[model samples]
Target chain A: MTTDLVVVLDADGRALRGRAPKLASEQLTAIYDAMVRSRVLDEGASELGPDELSHYEPTHGREAIDVGATFALQDSDWIVPRKHQPAALLARGVLFEELANAWLGKIEDPTMGRQLPGHYSFRSANFLSTSSTAGSHLSHAVGAGIGARARGDDTVFLTFCDVQGTSSNDFHAGLNLAAVHKAPVVFVVEHAPWEASERETASATIAAKGAAYGIPGVRVDGHDVLAVYRACREAVDRARRGDGPTLVEACTWLTDGDTPAWRCEDPIKRFEQHLAHQKLWDAAIGQRHFDTATAELAEAIALARTAGDPDTESLFDDVFMNLSPQLREQRRELARTATTTTIQP
Target chain B: MTATETRPGVKVMTMIEAISDALRTEMKNDDRVVVFGEDVGPKGGVFGATAGLHEEFGETRCFDTPLSECGIVGAGVGMAVYGMRPVAEIQFLDFIYPAFDQIVSEAAKMRYRSGGEYTCPMVIRSPYGGGIRGGHYHSQSSEAYFCHTPGLKVVIPSTPADAKGLLISSIRDEDPVMFLEPKKIYRHGKGEVPLGEHTVPLGRARIARAGTDVTLLAYGAMVPVCEAAADAAAEQGRSVEVVDLRTLVPLDEQTIVESVKKTGRCVVVYEAPKTCGYGAELAAILAEKCIEYLEGPVVRVAGFDTPFPYTLEHLYMPDEKRVLAGIDKTFAW
Candidate 1:
């Protein structure tokens, strides 16, 4: 079945009379800035040539879905991002230097360069590390949501995935468990427009699949930042009010082609035009945001390049609460065979 | 004999009852403890290992889940990470294949991968090993698979007392533990158990019987088998030391190496296949740490490298006869 796309903005960036001022002017400008920054980072990251680093799929055109869904969450709420969505971390205020160092597998990364690039995690920010395996983090989100309810904390968990991820058994298992237990979770699916063949072969729309698990499903125009934000805000509110999960499918076009039409459809560009129409954006303001983001990213890249690799002796850290006798012996053997170097504490 | 007391003033129970008691005690002490699996609630578990938990803890805490092993374990990992002590059952260790990814990839690696930011403090319990005519599907010693994975604790209890104590420790541990119950002796192995708050710590091996002639290292069902073999060796005027390695992953290397060093002869016994089995690890450790102390080559008495057989179950398992033969061969060598 075909689900209608929920849109709140017209082609000319005019909102309906009642919903025009739902978001404060400052919030809208911040969302636009975040989108621009994310787009710039993605473009620069993609330009970094092969240097023994694993390349992650760029979140080039899906900035609105990333920033909107993340901005709607409270500090207590949790977000489990997919492996490719670096914007989720950027929206959560992760430092660009940390992201750069993590991508370079340097010692300064929080995970000690263990995780791949774009798979960011910050416990203090309530953002879970992305699991490389598709659909694995869905159940973890459900569990966290249930845990929140059990602790009498009205915290909601939001997870992001793609159209193909819904086909995994873990996806169904998580949704079923959440529906049965009334877990406070929101599953946001970025339904890329280029996946028409995938959608055609599927039995139903990704949103409709939520109904089978007794969850409320809503589809939105992903390019419209206000629409996506509104849908996610409603879902988060419902979850905090003891209602079960909601599956939000943000239908978006993949603007990967080097064409002007694709560039025009960019979520960042669309939001910028909308802000300009509202007199909140101009050439000076746009240039300031661009310059700040470029300078910050350049500084982060330089810092990451100077960071050294993790010490060889530190390979046995964090494997368990404490190293067992076997591990201690193994570490000793490794220390004896390796060149001695000072390890960071 | 009265069912109440096998030994005066002491309660004698089977290994299964000891496991149930451990779960009950932990659930009573800590409200975060939860138990769930297929047929574990109203049906009281397929083997009655969780017989009274449902009636006592109520449906919310002790419940049944869909027959999805992956979901059962994956949810357990999530719950543990979210600050719940979940005790998930897999019915049989043979059925744990579907949940292997969740156990190895997610649960085991949660702390390490998250750089110690998150941890999965959960316990996965399943009845394992051959005997009782369970054939291939129902009976298989799969401890080696989990022991090979880092960041996971693997435990096996041989007697009723160890079952109660070790399980309590596993539930209270701050890491994911794979508790494999020896189904072969779950009912037949009854012993006097210490009542109330008894906990045998993980990574400690117990000397069932001390001797100087040979060191017989074993765990799980093989513990009793090796004990019997020690008794047989005593009849021949050869003293045999039996060391029960209750936990495999965090192996008590000091105890194992010390025992082999003192005896100068070692025989490792397990019901799993010989090649690349947990016994191989014991042999390698012995070779690495106690090679000079050994007067003979380290021997292994284990099941054949084949699927667990149905009617030939008795022959496939490592019995007292095979263990004794291994001891004698090592002495001759």
Candidate 2:
């Protein structure tokens, strides 16, 4: 309900001139460690894939928005992510190898090499597929919430979009439908206008758009993992209680704007500083988490490389529940000549 | 779950009534079955195809949605992915363009893109084709667009019985289905439909008439026109076989090839535009599989390549005489 930007930890990772939310040491450390792990995976993934597939949009400083918001929800809740967030997937219990499989476009992945890199889906974790279409996941999240409510389940659906994504028609229709039906959906908009220089043209607040749709809007400092978690937790609780949707706009930056130091604006460093202030983290703990993340990434990449590409005949599969006679014939024809390579004379 | 069991007895119903009965029957049997779209609840849809559903199943199961076709289809895809069999209604097929991205990109590809971990078990019901005197905005037969999508099942029912049966199968299928209703024949005739639990399998064609001279391949509203043309062909001492291709994606190619191979001549009838229409796919299949058995080139009796006209709709849509002329072309050649 508060339109003001909610900040718990300042840029120095120290408490600001306000009451900060309390959390258990383990919970705080877990959130911080997950953010660290995600940053490591992001760096590793950038260079892990083969050839042209190595390119990826690294989640350099948006760890808090991914890990923190996900930390607020339960395992039964659904996470509908538009962009790839390794932190969120890790928090949802997705294995590092599964992520590597998806990044490598291997058959072991849930999408079975059908999707491009970063378009992952883990049904066991209740994580929906990452849609490439901007703002389209908003309505799907709302519909998932509505469907769960109709089935008498209290599963909340959490979805995210960026400032530019708010301009899509689905954003308008999704929020309006969620509010009208009082669906259990929490929309999290990571407003980082600094990523795109042209994004500076629009000075409007993403949270303010929720007011026109009759939903409570709250803004939080995206760098502060605790602040994002608290705001998302409240929204999740509100949705679970059938009070309707809430839009939590987490304002963040891709890097330190005023200061040249990455530690000043890095979400993982800020959360680590907070943990240090709480006397729950130190260099040894940080090094151990970093080593674990690096080792896991190495193992995942190794296993992913061992896996072969999907079968050529699988190209015709999954187009429908059962392959029709037409696709069956196509699959047979593909298998016949798919292995033959023509050599130029 | 099981093969559709049709209990004894039948009730004479129109295509619209059959559609309503299908919705009611499926919603009654499966609590997960939901019927929704703009004006589908209280208004029972613009054509009354979903009439009495709201009263029968209440708002949760049967309700109206916002007027956004994209929202209706996209949300239905979400619901279906979440384990609900959503039978979403699009007032008219011409209005489905706004949801085309959702239909092709999201719903159709949900299962494939997700590697079967997630599936979209839903049916999108929409009235299609000309003869309703509607202008271009409301009368275009756009099923060809959906038929081109690999994962989507494009089904068109000509008779009331098939409308009810195919709809039931569509609802239970573990993939998305485009149940394009022929609004032109929504109430043209009443036929004896099974009382309850009658289901027709997808990807199968029905032989409307048996013949030995020429075969008329058609679907939806054109099925009746092809049959009537067969009667007219019989007067000229030529037996014309009419094949109703129920589902266009899987496309009863077996039956189509078999019929054409027997008849040695083929005429494809459709209400969509001639260029790149569904009839083109049919003719290609006939040429690919039955060319050796053919006696002449395949003729296509379809709507013009121009936009659907309001005032000149009767002239634009192919009638029985037009189909007969197509048959005569095959015989003359």
Candidate 3:
């Protein structure tokens, strides 16, 4: 018998755990500090900065970051994060420097800074680069998993998104390929409570949709890292053992800040308070972690302010690796004639 | 004279066989090379160009794909992006549309969008053009579609030697290339193709036959048609220079304009529809840049504006008669 759907919620909607973890923590201080830093990064990042990526909207729902799903995989496993959220990458050992560098389109960043802030990729980590269009990256992750399995290596691949991003042929094609090929790919689809303006009806759950394609779908409280870690561990174990693909709906909430134009849920503040109440961390340790995050972020901001903006030469240089003879001549002409161009603050 | 045996210094084999020999040679030369497509594995291609390929290379390198064109192309994109020199076959030109998304979206944009970080130096092979009784679906000339797309190198071979030599060169190129094999001329046109090793440079147009009166710019199956047209025009006391544009996207405009300036009259020929065809593009360029050198109106010998008709396909096709007529009209002007 299979469970239709599973929901793991903590009191105060903060520490929801859908699937519990099989792995034990070696660093309580480090994990707590990392979560504190993640929360600071979230709080510090201005969601209202600018509509830089105004072209494509989240297909069916407001973008919801799956909090607990990123930490459940092994060290060698690949994670294809399909959103701007850093919760998963944070767990996967992606540094804030690298994420920010990639976001700023720096050359040293993996994927050569070809991606936007949300779509992250790492060559060394084996993370498949994300595409701007919703479903293209999903299929690629599936292909990478297949390639890994073919080599007799059992490294599981993970991609986390929701039904909002799946309102495209890309999703259907990628998932279909994974299902038909029995690739060792586990999908974490975080369903939003609302679909842009429309509240999500029962029809939008990816579990029902994924079941139609022969991929086993599991729903868990996305808020609880332990619950997500536990479920994902099982899926990863099953995948490593050649059980084929799995789809997980980690039921999460958007808690940053809710607005008329968009919705947000403050997941971090609530979770930390729960940890304190349960004596998971002493009040002093928790306060210091938050204070350390604040100081480090302040230093990053100061360094960014002093580092200065990149010049216009980057525009032409970044376009090609080796410029053609004609393009070389054209660049010489641009140097001789075109006026200096600068970026505004 | 037998086509396969060299006439003292020349050997002639079918175009498809030359392609097979080239692929075979290239694979042996490089260890990282792989070939794939629908029906291209153990059974070879539908045209037998990849015949005996799987037997020699094993199914790992040379393999058949599921009937999904998009998957075939997308998988090639992935593999190429992963640093393998992959040669993906689209089976037929008409069916290559399903992979156009992969071509234009992922393959073409990878280098540019990555700011030169990642590139897919992959080659897509498909049999294109009409002359055989393939009618609308299979026989349609689709080179113009790829020609209009930027960041893609498009190559078409008119002879057996070129078919093999160019395929080898395209595989080694550091850019995405659409290698269109004229299906009608695959076995129909035979010539001596160097067997040992050879490479043809891309973005260069060859003056197939040179003369003075008019310049005939053409490619693919139409190279033969233009040769016949030039021969027919020569009988009328009019000499013609034929320029075979092997690669169309990054066109050899300099070569074309130079040939046109010398001839003082020009005619462009292709098998695709007359409107928005490669011929029209050439016409516009000549009119704008080489207008003073042209002694006559640039005439076009191409397929009709309508969809390729089934029964009237032969008539709709730009044949020797139509090409000759077009040349004659341009000479008169």
Candidate 4:
């Protein structure tokens, strides 16, 4: 008797080592640059906390969201960045300044000072918006895929972190909708292990979890950008060709820089270590990329710090597009209330 | 907007046929119309409301779908938002809960969220209000579930004419509508449905019977029950007015409050269970908004608190006898 079981990266990131597939140096450089930028942006940005204070705790365990997904989707394709996907959003197209401003809780933040800090949105970028509600936004990504298929656009990329604990109805509902519609969405569930909490997934393999839904699941080494890119590309192309959605499990590790809030280990460093042995590029070039990113990020951080100064009065707008009579009166009262009050300063 | 008065005539047709006639006429008039759901296509729907649909229009217009309710509803939301006036028929309203997220959140909210950037101008028609004994899973009165959600227009018609007209109007309403057809009334109840294309705008109520002493606000299968109760009340020398709220959600509050004002006494009736049921909404609206107009407390006659019981369905449902008792309670008060 034969049993079918799919493996989700059974190999250890520690023991496993392989040479990258053939690619031009620039293409290789771009992928490495993307990973570096992802790390730098991920290092600087605060994903989940109070509106003004993201308190940048780097992403732990979910390196695939950036290194893999960046190469997974085409440059023009839109990506809806969930609250935790700072690395993914940075790789997708969000600038360091935008993430910083968003963290500072500036008026210019795409969330319009409404939702919390990590929930960024850009309507023009094809990416709709992100929310803290666990898997509720996936359907919109699925809808974007449906639109992509109709327009003959190549593919769309979507990312999520599955805690198994947040196995709320939204998670099942979102994925089931994608699977049933056979929408052109490639769901990358960063199989978050302990740190968010120490609980392991009920299943040993992501493939086993995905197989329950009759979707194909493949695990990629999250630290290896080339491996992640290759795996995501296959899933995305399948969706673009109308074959249907694929669930990719990119097994990753949280590193030293990772804080409990939003921690991801440096894929660039790991990839560089791997590439050094493979004789891909000089170690100095990789070091320069890191040096350049830190310097640029420091300036961007200062600009974000001073540029956005929001007071209590700034909170009044966007509650309702056109404030109702009742709301207008409330705003007036609040303004009067604030004016009569004094500051300790 | 024109009153194409349709005289009453006895027409023996299945409830499914009346629904088919409604959908067929609407599809014929509008080119943007499309229909799809589980077992809906080549199957003409499990009951055949879409029987001639696939034949009349191409498979592209009417088709079968995967057994995914969320997928079906979400896709319908997408199609409705884009431009196509999609008529998504959930094989049964009982199965619609799986897709409740899209129905209540996305479809109902597209217009408001987009600040009118888009609208889910579509119709979600399903067999609802289980008088046919579809068992616990198959039989349920779920209009109250959709009515509670805003940005969704809910319509449940009791007669053939209102069924056809309200359905047509719901299809074109520039809003998402949950159009529930009383499964039991399809063949058992009959009246004249106008021959040509017609539409009954949403947010309008019809007076089924005019009486002075009391008002009976009812809808769906309960309309006939209220009518029967009015007759029984007449036997007791009690004059009762019957108002059929054809569209329940935008809920012609004026008609309800106006009728209550004239009658002085009112009993809100429905077949859905008593807890958080649509009748409660009606009763509360009357009590707070139309309190001064009422001569007595508004009584609600509805299904029991239990899940729709199969054995005692008669007892589980609100009938003429129970409705009259409710009216009696109001009068006594």
Candidate 5:
């Protein structure tokens, strides 16, 4: 399963000679900070609600893929997440307060409490709105690629999906269409085989599937943040140059990272060790980033908790560009019910 | 901009030609408008509704897509969200089921789900209805499916002129539009259409033939049948009115209600199945609003509750005769 994977950092956080990406000390620190913020938010959301955190805990080990791939993308590039990628969203400039509001479904939430905790739509940051249905956003990425090219810009589109997304119908349709149309898109799959067994997918790695669609596929160690960045940056560069799409498989696992072996695979600790090896890590700086992230998450959650629920009247908004006459009547009917509530008492 | 005003010249065209004219007019005016679907490029669509668009607009603006309806629609949603007005043809309404999720879930909900920051101002133009001997796979009127979904504007034009204008208006609309073209009347429904920049606003109905005794409501290909039935009813001294409801979602309820209240009778007609068909909604609206003005029960002249058949499509379709009978039911009541 580890065939031809581009590995930069080992399990012990030692960088392979000449394989690590050339990033400045600040850039490295920022990437590490984003990963820590993601981890903190993931843990902090548990205090928001256990029912919401249930969906966030199992997919915690793949923070490297989220932050690494996001760092490789430019500000103009669009991000279509197959599922929740809070680390990626945060790296793309989404505010922690907004993310917290979305999780709490507060009135100030940009989505107006329409979606679940992790189903985000931050258009200001070029993040596409996500849905609960799997594989639906794949073709949207391809379409965005075509659209960006059509606008006569070099903007690229990056999408993150799970390993099982390869088996969906939209996966084939999106890849084939992107290749056929030479769309500027990069498909990155966090290849954590949670559902598919080894016997079922043992014949070939998920990266090889790109060849059938006439696109190049590269496999990378998902836990190695630099490795994922290198692979995704190359793909992004190729796509922006009008070379069509490239599929990058960031291979990791779905785990809680509590056990000894799983702990070694922690993307955050591995990156901290790499920073310490480069004489860039210190106890004070590490504690500052962790505390800052924790405090930010706590403050955001606290503020979102104080906000009221979305106004009931806003439910009728955004159904169309303008509310039709029929909708106007319906809104009036809802208002009547609201006014009549006091009369009943 | 709304092109309610048009040039002086007018040209007689079939429904298909009017549709092509609308696409060409919009693409020429706005560079953001793109037309693509299966066989839409060099083949000019299976029904030639997109004829000469690829040659005129080039491959980037008007091109072909893979044989996946979901890909076609999903890509259109993406392009629209990226600030392009894409008109994606689904070949036929029957084949649109595969892309139904992309249509209802992605395209329709993009505006509301994104909190109005993102929108899918795209058009999904598909040929529908059970004429042309196309049977179930090629035919079948499925506008009711899209009409039921919120955030989507379902439009079915009855005349060639209305087709061009309505298609243009749908292209310019801010929400997702299900531009259901009647394949049955693609060529047969011919009339004088404006040369350029004509717009028939949505959520409005046209009085095809004014009368007093009864009001017959229909859209798309069925509008012509209702008109013919109204003409026949006129000869029998029945004075029937034919109302062409161009857009179904932001519905022209005022016009339909006014027409029904004036006539005191209503006959709803459609080519789809009778059970839970669009005609049922029309009947219910009439029953709710125009109940006191009604002189009879709201009769629906529609296809029987059966799959569209190859040989027996004639019996399955509600034609001039069936509509006339429906008119008689309103009179008898």
Candidate 6:
């Protein structure tokens, strides 16, 4: 379940003597800020109305994998995040207001209230849309990698999935395609065994699945942001160099109480202790970041609430480049009978 | 960009060859166009529909994929949204089930789901319909599945010329198009195709034959069946106008309504099962729009509502006899 490749950071967040990936203090602080903001946003969303709460799934304990993997990529590279990994979009610079609008299905939402909450797609930011279906985006990552290579661009595609996603047929198909074509893709899986079953042990780690496709795989501690960052950065570098895909399994527990021993393994708590040991954290600094995140989310929620629902006409838009004659006729009929009241039929 | 070798005049080719020609021409015309599928590379595809593409376009532009339908389609969706006009071929329409999620949930919803911020301009070309005795696994007419999904353009060309033209247009389209190629006519159906730059815009139907008694509505493989039935009806002094619904989704409803209005009787024909088939939609449209013009109830000649059987393949499909029966019943009414 562990390997030499797992870059274990000490309790103080320092690498075992000069083994740390060289990240600037500001960059480390920014990563911490992103994690805090993501946590705050999720907490706020969890307390929303039942209509909104139904779509929001909290990525409470896995912010490190989301932030670290996303921050490792360049602006030109693509990130196909899982539905639970809104933190990846936050790390990629999606505006908090826009995310809130999308989450609330407001008129200003980029998706026009089509997708559910937490599913984000920012084309300008090179982040593909997330699908609710498990492991479906893996093939899309491979396709984007193929597209980059075809255009002679060195853009790597990074996608994240949970441990159970590795068992999906799409996961296998995507990895196999990447291997055969030598596509530049990095797959990051947040490994949690209990998500599959309580009786299921760590019998076969997700990292080993890469060998079937002749790609190298690594396992890292998901609790360590620097560890996840280093592993994902190396994979990204390899992909950029045309070395093909690398599957990195970030071993972390999805639940705070998955087991008594894992209760203390919260990624945010672990990183906070590391930052405090490195003389980079204090009660004031932590409070300032937490307070800023809370205020920003509150403002975003207020703004989202002010936005109107999508116009009835927008329902007919984006179905095609131009609506067909049949669609045009249908739209006319809908417009004629349109009402603000939801029909109970 | 290398220019596709153009012929001096019109060229006669089969539907499969016309499809291959369209792919080569589009790939040569636009660098963004990429074609890939199972056996499409060195093998030129199982039916030779993609013959010589790998050699002509090289492995990167044209290549083979693993035996995974979902991967093929999902990858195509990804490539498309990332700004590539990917043309993915599913070996057969029946095999497209594994990739149905990618088509319906991903490809079909990308643009609307992203609010037009992202568009998937991709073509999924799969051979459909049953006639070659390939049995259930290899033979199916599943165009209705895609036609039912919004944000997708479903096209099924009936002639070699229409195949070339509609495919060229589908490739150039800005939305995801499910180009269902009728495998029954892949080689059997031959016609004179335009030499170069021929494009048949989608959502348009072609009147294969002009008549006055009954309007015979068909598409894909059923076009030929309707044609033969029209000929048989002609022998009986019954004039049947045959309408080829080239693109089912954007459905040339105008043409269908006009044809039905001109010919007071209408008979729909298709190879899919009768219940909830595309014929049902056609019948409903006719009932709603052309009811007063109709001389009889909208009759349908279609496969029985059962699994495509091996021994009764002939009986399962709506052949010329069944189509004639539909025409006769309409005339009688």
Name the 10 consecutive residues with the lowest summed lDDT in model 4 chain A. Answer: A1-10
User: Model 1 segments beyond 4 Å from truth?
Assistant: A1-3, A16-21, A193-201, A253-264, A343-345, B1-10
Local accuracy by lDDT, each model: 0.84, 0.85, 0.69, 0.68, 0.86, 0.86
Q: In model 5, where do residues sit more than 4 Å from their true spots?
A: A50-59, A197-203, A254-264, A339-345, B1-8
Each candidate: how many clashes? 0, 0, 13, 8, 0, 0
For every candidate, C-alpha RMSD to the true structure in Å? 3.2, 3.9, 5.4, 6.9, 3.6, 3.2
| DockQ each | 0.63, 0.71, 0.31, 0.12, 0.78, 0.82
Q: Which lDDT tens digits does candidate 4 get at residues B124-185? A: 98888777878777778888878777577789888877888888888887788899988878
Pairs that clash in candidate 5: none
Question: Hey, what RMSD does candidate 3 come out at?
Answer: 5.4
Residue A37, candidate 6: Cα error in Å is 0.8
Residue A151's lDDT within candidate 5 is 78
Considering every candidate listed, which one attains the maximal DockQ? 6
lDDT of 6 by residue, A90-140 (tens): 787777898899888888888898888878877767878778887889999
TM-score of each: 0.93, 0.95, 0.82, 0.76, 0.95, 0.95
Order the candidate numbers by DockQ, best to worst: 6, 5, 2, 1, 3, 4
> So what's the TM-score on candidate 4?
0.76
lDDT of 1 by residue, A173-249 (tens): 78888787787889998877655525543544577888888899888778888888989999999998998899998
Model 2's CAPRI class? Answer: medium
Instruction: Kindly list the per-residue Cα lDDT of model 5 for residues B1-333, writing each as its tens digit.
Output: 112234358777888888988999999999999999999998899988888889998988999999999999999998999999999998888999989999999999998987888999999999888879998898788888888999999999988899999999999999999999988888884688998799999998999889999999999889888888888888998998899999999899999999999999999999898999999999898888879999889998998889899998888888999999888888886
> Model 2, residue B286: displacement in angstroms?
1.0
Show where candidate 6 strays beyond 4 Å.
A3-5, A197-202, A254-263, A341-345, B1-7
Report how far off residue B128 is in candidate 4 (Å): 1.8
